[model samples]
Each structure stands twice: as C-alpha cells, then as structure tokens.
Target chain A: MIEVKNLSKTFTSHVKEPGLKGSIKSLFSRELVTKDALKPVNLNIEQGEIVGLIGANGAGKTTLIKILAGIVHPTAGEAKILGYTPWERANEYRRQMALIMGQKNQVWWDLPALDSFILLKEIYQIPDAQYKYNIEFLAEILMVKDQLKTQVRKLSLGERMKIELMAALLHNPKVIFLDEPTIGLDISAQKAVRGFLRQYQKEFKPMTILTSHYMEDIKELCPRIVIIKSGEFVYDGSLSDVQKMMGDEKVLSVTTQNGVFKVSVPRQDLAKKTHELFEEHYVLDLNIQDPSIEDVIESIMKNGIGAT
Target chain B: MKWWKDVMGMELRKILAYRSDFWITFLGQTFIQLMVARALWQAIFETQGVSEMQGFTLEMMGLYYLIAPIGMKILNGPNFGFLAQEIYDGTFTRYLLYPLSVFQYKTLTYLTYSLFYSLQMIILLGIYRLFISEVAFTSVDVGHLFLGLLLFIIGAIAYCMMGMMIEMIALWADNIWSLAVMLRFFTSFFGGALIPITFLPVWAQNILVWTPFPYLLSLPIRTIMGLSTFQEVTQGALILMLWTLIFMEGVKLVWKKGQFKYTGVGI
Candidate 1:
C-alpha cells in the first residue's frame, strides 16, 4: 500500500533579467522566486490497483511522482510505500519499486540493452533462474527480443521504450510509477505498450500510478482517475463517477445536407434536441453520446473541482 | 566482487565500442606531446651547449617526458564531467533510484579507466626497454617499483575524488566545464607533467612538495624511475591519502545538501 499525507514540493530559483546590463547587475543583486510545484495533497493506493493521474502540463503530476519515487525531496508531508519512507532510499524499499520516465532513458545508449540488463541484474542481485526467466518472459511479451542485442541508440523509439519497460520490470517490482510511459509513440506502438502494461499488471498485481495525456490510456487501463490542477488534486474517483457528476449531460451531433452541428445537452433534453434539429434541417446522420473523457477533463482543468 | 567485475566489463565494452577513435586519440595525444617536448628540450640543450641541466641528462629528460604523460594519464582517469552533466540534464535521477551507491559506481568506473591506462603504460615501457638503446635507467628495483605502484593507485584515487568534488559543484553552478578545465591545467602544470619539478627553482619545488599535485604525476614517475627513496614515497602517500579523505568528505556534504535542491528537471 502507498500512503501519502500532506505531501508538497516547492522550488526556489533566482530571477534574472534580460540584456547584458541586467545580467551584470543581477550578479551583484538578484531576486529569488518560489513556486509550489505540488501542494499538500493526500492519497492512498492499494495493491493491484492502477490509478490514472490526469493533469495539464506543469500541473504537479510529475512532481508528485518524483516525490514518491524518491527522486525529489518533498518540502513537507510524509509518504510511506510498502511500509517504507521513500526518501530514506532504503535498499529493500528500492528493490521492490520501479520508476519509469518516458522522457528520460536509464539505459546506456552506447551499449546493447542486454549489457545494461546484465549490469542491472548484478545491481539488483537477482537469482540466475529468476533473472533468466524474467528476461525471456519480458522480452517475449514486449516483442523486442531481437532488438535487445542492438545498441539502445540504434533502436527506434518504440523498440527502445519496450526495452526500457522490460528493464524496469526485470525485478518484478511490487510498486510501479509510470510517468507518461507512452508519450511520443505511434498509435500502434502505443497500443502495444498499453497491452504489455495491462498484461504485466495482471500477472504481477503491482500497484501502479500512471500519468499520461492520452485519454485512451486512462479509459482502457485505469478504473480510477485523479484530476490535478495547479498543484492540487481537484477530483478523485472513477471515470463513470466523474461522468455522472457532470449532471447527466450527453453530446449531440447531427450531420445535415448543409452542415454538421455538435453540442452538449442534458440527458433528459437529448431526445427533444435531436428531434428539433431533425425538423429544422435535412439530417443525413445524427448521434447522441456521453461527453468524452477528454471534454470532461478539459472542463475540470479550466474550472475548479465543482465545475463537474 | 562479481558485480564490480560485471560493471568493469561493461565499462571496457563502452571503451572498445569505437576502437579506432580510442586508439587515435590516446596514441596521437601522447606522441604529439612527446614530440613537442623533445623539440623544445633539444633546442634548450643545444643552445646551452651542455650535456645535463638540473641533474637530468638529455636522455633522462627524454625518458622523463615519455613517462610523465603516462603517469598523468593514469592519475587523471576518465572524464570527470559525467556527474555534473547528468545533474544539469536531470539524468542524475537514475542514480537516485538505483539500489547502489553512485560514488562507488563512479569510483569503479574511474578505476577501470585508470587500470586500462596503466596497462598501456606497462606495455609501452616494456617495448621501449626491449627496442630502444641507451635507456636511461638500466636496472629496475622491485621494491621501488612496488612502492611506485602503490603510490600510483593512491594518487589516482585521490585525483578521482578531487574530480568528483569539483563535479558536485554542478548542484549549484550552471556550468562546471570551465572549472574542470582549470583543474586539468593546474594539475598538469603544478604536478610537473609540463616540466620536471627538478627544473623549477628550489623555492617553487619546496612549495609544490607540500601540495597534492606532485604525488599525482611527478613523484610517482620519479619513484618508479628509482630516483625517490622509500621514505619519500611513503610520506607522499600519506599526504595524498589525507587529501583524498578531504575530497571524499566534501563530496558527501555537497551530495547531502544538493538532494534538497534537486528538482529532477533540467536546469
């Protein structure tokens, strides 16, 4: 189980003005500014559960992940993962946890992925049987067995990401923190990664916290979602609960001979609105659907938690 | 021990990835420096019309120049900017996540490079002894050689810690490259890689002896060449060890404080 209480992170940086004159002046006297990257937030995640963190850029998603992963120190609050404080960086705790960042790679670029895996095996001290089995199983599932022998720098982005996933999962961590793991991949590659992750989670039953911009990833993999805005958690619940909180609204789209119209209406008024649109124009096609997860998230991001 | 061996193997593979590049750079730099030293020293000797200066004959000076570079190379180890660059780019996050000590890993990497250069030095020395005539030192004393090897290892480790100490400044400084370059220059000049310490004035030599620079290159070469006594090498070892301890402490303190400042994002 992961328990976080009043966790926060604040970054302080010096402000520099533009131009040579300002640069020289600031060297003698400068102003410092502080920004709260993460506010005091509380969260609890249980084993075998995958929680999706939804937020816009600079919304503290990554900061929260970094804090929990022990990569960054929190300004305030306490967090216990599997009964261990992460920032202390105990070996037993680190051994059972894995942090994978999509934008950054941990593999050595100049060497084959297998070489890096060997080094990791030594670092983690996995038994021969377990290490060999994991290597085979992860390679087969991710479908990058051939590419493992190639240099990481030589592999395509998709292949490299697969190798990275395999590397992170080699120890079969009990807790996984994935930060935009599918970013910058093609649609097919994205699907492949999602499929692999889903299977891995099912087999290992590790607690996973994933943050991504792709709604499909959340919709397909996560049963629970948390929305963060400006360094705070605005809403935390299942997708259906959030949709219901939007007050029984449905999106209506009508394509007529002249043009296509799309709008949102309350569920009770959906039928009347569709009929009125059909009567007003020569409708070739019409459809009524629930508001997209993307729309709901965008609205929540723009407004406060009560916007739903 | 097995883990260290595996890591060392990986480091070796990385070094061998571009064989031609490594060979060209290593050999080219060594020979070019030797050539320049040879030209300058020959001119000085000819103009002075003397067979010897500062207790070093022309042959001894040539041998000194040849061995000094290898000694310095062994001490310098691999690139020290690795940690600083990783900190600047936010890639240092990986080290935090790994269940191993970053300092230990870096020290091992440095040792691997130093060991490889030591091997080159050995092979070069053997070749020179076998092929060249008029070798300056005819006989090798096993005791002196052993002492020299010990001091070489200590000096290399000391230099590694010093490099890391400079690199930890990346936690606050925007750029550490200039500082690193400055360290390299100071080590080469003060350590007597550029010119023999014996050629310097007595006052300058006395001042440098108290510093860690001479143990890094000059003293080690002189010890191996059978010019320095066992007592002198022992004293130098003690001083280098003290310096290494200081650097180790500085690195630890910086790392402890720097963790709070790290945002895990590129600066």
Candidate 2:
C-alpha cells in the first residue's frame, strides 16, 4: 500500500543568538543552519500491517510521516502510497488515506464535533447513507456518541482525541498515518484509542503506520518497529527483535534498608557497566543485557551513535 | 452539480453551528460600513453639492455612496479568514491530507460566510435604502441587480484567491499578518471602498483602473449604479474576467509550490 525509497527531508533553520549585538548583526547578515530532519529513509508496507516508528526527540518520525502523508515535500527520493506518488497528492490517493495527529486536533474547537464531521462528509463527498452509518458505528465504538454534540473545547483531552479519531475514520480511509495518536491521555483513554484503532484495522484491514514515544502504544498497535536516531534509521524489525538486539539489557535495583540498593548480577556476567553508585548503599546500576524499548532508546541516545 | 450541492450544504451546516458569531459579525459589519459610507456622502456634499460626476445627482451620489460600501460588506466579507494562521499552525495539513482540494475547501468556507453575511447586509441595506438613501432606483431592476451580484461574487472569489496566494507565503515566513495588513490596505484604498474612483486624480485613477483591486469591489457597484455606459460596462466586465482568470492561475501555481515549503512542524 505504501513504498518509500530513500526519501529524505531537510530544513534550513535560521540560528540567531540572543543579546543585543547578536540580534543587530543578524538583522543585517542572517545565518542559516541546514538541519536534516529526516535522512535518506526507505520502507514499504503491505495491506493490513501496522508499522511503528520509534525515535528520540529530534528523530525524523514526524518528518517521514508528513512526507508520506503529502503534507510536506521531501528534499529527495521517491515515495508512493496506494500506487500514486504521494507528493503529487492526487485526489484518488487522498481519498483512501487518513492522517491523525493526537497532539493536534482536526475537529473545530468552538463548534460541536458533529459540525466538523458534517463539513468533512461533504468535502469527502461521502454518500448520505454511508456517512450516517460510518458515524454511527464509529461513535459507538469510540464511545463518543454523546460527546459529538458537546463543543470540542469543553471535552476532556481523551474525549477530544476520540472525536478526532472518529473524524479521521468517518470516510473509511484505506490507509492510516498516525503520529503520536495516544499522547497526553490517561491510560484508560490511551487503551480506548488503541482498541478502536485495532478494531478499525481489523475491519477495514488498511495499511497502518504509527509513530509514538510511548512504548506501550507501539507494543499494543504495531508488531514491527522501525527505530531512527538523529535523522538516520538504525533499527527495523519486529518489536521482540529490538528488545533482543539494542535493548538486550535489564534494569535491576534491589531496594534495601535506608533506601540502599545493590545490583544482582552474577560475577560471571559482564563486569563492565555504567553503575550509578549513590552515596547511600542504594547503588543504582545500569547494565547491557535485555532491557525494555525505553531503556534501549536511552542507551542509543547516550552512546553517541556515529551513523546508520 | 453534486459537487456544488456538497460544497454549499457543508457550508450551510457550518454557518448554522456558528449562528451566534454569524449574527455578531453581520451586525458589526453593517454598522461600520454604513458609518463610513455616511461620512463619505456628507463630505462629498459639503465639498460639491449635487455633483454630476459619475452620473451622481446629490441624491444618487448619497445613495451611490451608501450602496457601494454596503455592497462592499457583501463582497469582501468572505475574503477575510484564517487561511494564513492555519498554515502556520499546521492545522491546514489535515485539510490538505484529506480527499479534497485546497481550492474547494477555501472556496466552500468563503461561500458559507458570504451567504450568511450577505443575507444580513442585504436586509440591512434594504432598510437603510428605505429610510436614509435619499433617492432609490425607481425601478430597482432585479435582473441588473442579480447580474451585479453575480459579478460581485466572481470578483470576491478572485480577490479571495489572491489573498490565499499571499497567505501561502506563511509557509516560509514566521509572521505573515503584517503582509496581510499591507495587502488589505492597498486593496481597500485602490478598490474604492473608502471613496469613489471618479474623485481621485485622473492620473492616479488611470493607474489603478487597470488593476484587479478596483474590479473586486467597485465594478459591481458601477454595474448596479449605472456609472458606466453599456459599452464601458461590457469592456470592464471583460477586464474583470481577465483578472479573475489570472488570479485563478496564480492560485494554482502558488499553492502547489507552497506545499513544498510547509514544514508540517505542528502536524
């Protein structure tokens, strides 16, 4: 459903230092710093598969998603979604795909979610019967049937995010691009979103690509994972592969009296490890051997990775 | 036909949802436009009583002044919106990524607000014409008025497209509001919203006459107020059509290029 070959996006940013002199100098002679938000990246996704993009803060997850969704053009390389070039963004290509961002809302703030949905239904040119049916099914599954009439600003974050999902799914898109779709919500809200997405994917079997820092979100939605650091992709495989490879380490802290702690590593295990020795016997130690996805990310960032 | 129905129906629902804001903006727009029109009419009389320039008797002059500005509220009202802010805030990406054209989205939204605002302004203009417009068109040729309204709508669309073209610059610039203000200032002054073009220095009017800004608001008023002969009106509409075509072409080019520049930072 989607193919991206060596796609890359670079942004030119102006760097101005603070201080009166620096500001004055910039006014006359501005300096630019080219930032590679996304290095040359490649990927492909088949129908009914969920792919997760994981990375550090400056990683290129959002940039890659934007390029694939046809919101931002890449500096180089080729990308096609649903057999049409994404950057060209033909109407046919747009109709089959939906992009959802959890942090930012697509629903109108002051108006009820129903109003935005009505507007989108016409814009998408959905037939009346199909539109009504889709909204009804989505509203029921997402538990937002009553909240549709409430003003968007009045809803809780979880409520608003559910409505956003409903808006994105109203047209029954065949491919979905989700960026941090479960961010800033309680665990229950996050679980609800994940459940709805899983059901949507199962029913429609659309090619789904998701990006999220929350490891649990990825584990819940996507079986395969792609990890990028500092713009270049470093890892791509199943979720278990990541935990076995880069994250083959465990966190062990023994809470003792007076908050004193010690590591429970056998003398035979690798002796070399960065162990944080607290003044108290609570020696917090870090080692390399099977860790969670979060710890792996921290290790990758900490270890000054050369390049991919 | 289906496309038009979908576009208009969507717009209607949006207006209904924001009914309160619609009434507030309409009332404010009518009061402000009328006040400006009244002041201009008084100034014209104070300077040259019963001036015949542009076929205005003192009464026709006052009514012309009144109609032109109220006509302005109808034409340019839809032209102002948050196209630029949406781009800067990354909210516009949702629309772009959807199965819709930016042209269709903007044009539909503009039509909705235009329908709501124009209805109110037309009613207010009717009441004002009854009491304050010293002389009215005795016949009130509905066909001419309809044609004038049609031209006005075309002009509004073209003008709003031009605004979108300028707003597209927000993809690159951090702050685009100043550029928007500058665009508005020139369009308002050159478009004859403040005063009739006939009173301007001949050379100044001659320079602006060729520009599209005048067609945006003034040409429709001219068509209805009978400021031009049939031959001149036909020629002017042709020029307006040319401007609209050029603006439409510009919108396509700018929007296509502007998408490349959008960072999608927030989205």
Compare the candidates by TM-score and give the number of the best one: 1
Candidate 1: where is the Cα deviation over 4 Å?
Answer: A19-25, A252-262, A268-288, B132-134, B139-146
The residue ranges of model 2 lying beyond 4 angstroms of the native Cα positions read A127-129, A246-250, A254-267, A270-290, A304-308, B1-3, B16-20, B36-61, B134-140
DockQ for candidate 1, C-alpha atoms:
0.65
Per-residue CA lDDT of model 2 for A38-111, tens digit only, reads 88988988989999998888788888888888888899999888899887889898888888998898877877
Q: Write the per-residue lDDT of candidate 2 for residues B1-267, one digit (tens) a residue.
A: 355565576566656657777676656665666666667676867787655656556566555665665566555545444588888777887777766677777776676655565566457657766776626564345556666666677766766777788888887775689888888778767887666777778999889877887777677776666554567566667887787788788888887677778877676
Local distance difference test scores for all models: 0.86, 0.74
TM-score of each: 0.93, 0.89
Give the per-residue Cα lDDT of candidate 2 at B225: 64
- Where does candidate 1 chain B have its weakest 10-residue lDDT segment? B132-141
Which residue pairs show backbone clashes in model 2? Answer: A248-A289, A248-A290, A249-A289, A249-A290, A249-A291, A260-A282, A261-A282
Can you give the lDDT of residue B164 in candidate 1?
Answer: 85
Least well predicted 10-residue stretch by lDDT in candidate 2 chain B: B73-82
Best-fitting candidate, measured by lDDT? Answer: 1
